[model samples]
Target: MKTAGGDAAAKRRAGERAAEEVEDGTVVGLGTGSTAAYAIEAIGDAVADGLEIRAIPTSFQSRQLALEVGIPLTTLDAVDRVDLAIDGADQVVDDPDATAHGTLIKGGGAAHSREKLVDAAADRFVVVADPSKLTARLDRSVPLEVLPDARTVAADRARVLGGEPTLRAAERKDGPVVTDNGNLVLDCDFGAIESPADLARDLSAIPGVLEHGLFVGLADATYVGTDDGVEIRAY
Candidate 1:
């Protein structure tokens, strides 16, 4: 069946849940991207309605959005810990539990380096996505963050893993879009990652790999907003 307003509706449901999950005086890790943008706005609405919480953003974009939405801001350096981190994913899986895999492919906005760091600092990670993002297998859409000088080298290494690696599509004509940490990104196609953890490990072992957008079994659960309604998947 065709999903009605698929992406937009799914994002709205996820953002609503994210906003409802916060508590007074809570510390949260705000994520980046279009879906996370909604999550930020939902939290802001909550704040405007008297749900006060301090949010530490994972990227510059996130920070700005959070500010614009009226979510109180702080730095990870200033905050001791995050109660939870709400983010989005490019794809998920049929397994509701691992629907999106605790692991994820992020930095679609080129924030992988910092996003990874912030994720490492969070205690709980929640990924929100539309049902369409759920897949039976991971595929060509893998996003890889690499050092500029080692772009070709990294692409070659990814080929050793049975995938073709291409530079991430750049929106700007004058320059490749630089990540928040100054790294360049390559979108790789590994087809189906039988062992995402192993793949993530291999990629991480590479010298020039700043971070691969793969979550590698890091998520506890995912909330999928389907055409019918919201479904909770635990993994």
Candidate 2:
């Protein structure tokens, strides 16, 4: 495992490498989380250096960060298509045959509902992360956004899929963590996932599942920051 400072530095390097894809007069998709926050800052700096770009943010947190960095903001509804999306992943598995972006487990920050939307809307989606985030297989719990009223139904479905579902709770506030879309998040632990695409389809078919963290066929490429240098993996 990398030290805290090493992880931060790696994340910044990955973010900077991804930011190199941005160009003037492009519609970019800004993602959420700590790794993506570094990308947001880099994009902000790019804007300061006179890169004319409009961004659609995946979360409120990203929106604020983009504003602080001086990147112009836009809504998805106002754009025809996003040129590119640079985001981060919780876990990335190198499975070229599995999906276009390989297999990614995201939503650690609880913004996956919108993250999925923005990722799919882009012409190209790039994931930026440090080496610590890569895994031989996805073993982390997949996050599913559920409607408030459909929590029980979602949990039951998760159980049927061999997952132990737990409602994510707020750290500061009481009760469940609510998404920006006014939904609850269920962290479903299925141990090591074998087929991420099949599981993603199954979870999507479930009623009241706003979105799940299994990002299939969305990643065009991934930039992994390493001690030696940045590693670019294309799918």
Candidate 3:
């Protein structure tokens, strides 16, 4: 088993590598999550060194981090295009047939709805992950941000699609975890997903589901951190 420190180091490796992709005078989409945090810090360091760029953060967490690191922020509405996006995944699996590195399961932070928007808008989306996130198949629970009033109905619909939906409860709070968008999250488990695209479609079709965690055909590349070093995979 990998220690927390080792995992953190690996995450830093991948994240910093992904940050290197950013260029001057570009609008970057900053992603959320622990791994992505490192990328944000790396970009901040670059900015301090005179790498001129603007950023559109995917979540409140990312926005705060960017501010702390002195990275200039912008709104999506103000930008015509995002040059690149760097993000992390809960799980990533290789798909030989796809143009990207593979499929990704995200939203462990309950920020998938916004993350998807920024990632999709970017000219290129790069995923950063540690070895632990890599898998032969995406079996991790898929996070779905649902409208608060439609949580129960969305759960029912998710079950009809063959998933076991569970409301994500808060760790310290009393009720369920609320997303930044004022939505609830349903973590739907589908064992081992055979076709991620089909499941994504079905999940999206469900009413009140703002977004699901299956990121299909969005990643342009992946940087995986391993014990030896960082491995770069391009699609």
Number of the top-ranking candidate, with lDDT as the measure? 3
Off by more than 4 A, model 2: 1-6, 95-101
Candidate 1 — which residues are off by over 4 angstroms? 1-6, 96-102
Q: For model 2, how does the per-residue alpha-carbon lDDT over 2-117 read when each residue is reduced to its tens digit?
A: 22333888888898889989989999999988888888888899899899999999999899989988999999999898999999999888755543336799998899989999
CA error at residue 9 for candidate 1, angstroms: 1.3
* TM-scores for candidates 1 onward, in order: 0.90, 0.95, 0.95
C-alpha RMSD by candidate, in order: 3.2, 2.3, 2.3
Q: Who is ahead in TM-score, 1 or 3?
A: 3
Deviation of model 2 at 19, angstroms:
0.6
Residue 87 alpha-carbon offset, candidate 3, angstroms:
0.3
Evaluate model 3: give its TM-score.
0.95
Q: Write the per-residue lDDT of candidate 1 for residues 1-235, one digit (tens) a residue.
A: 1222347877778766765777888888888777677778888988999987898888898998888888889888998888888887776655544433555766667786777677677887777778766777666467788889999999999999887887876676766777777888888888888877788888887778888888866666677776667777777
lDDT of each: 0.76, 0.89, 0.91
Residue 231, candidate 3: Cα error in Å is: 0.7
35, model 3: CA deviation in Å? 0.8
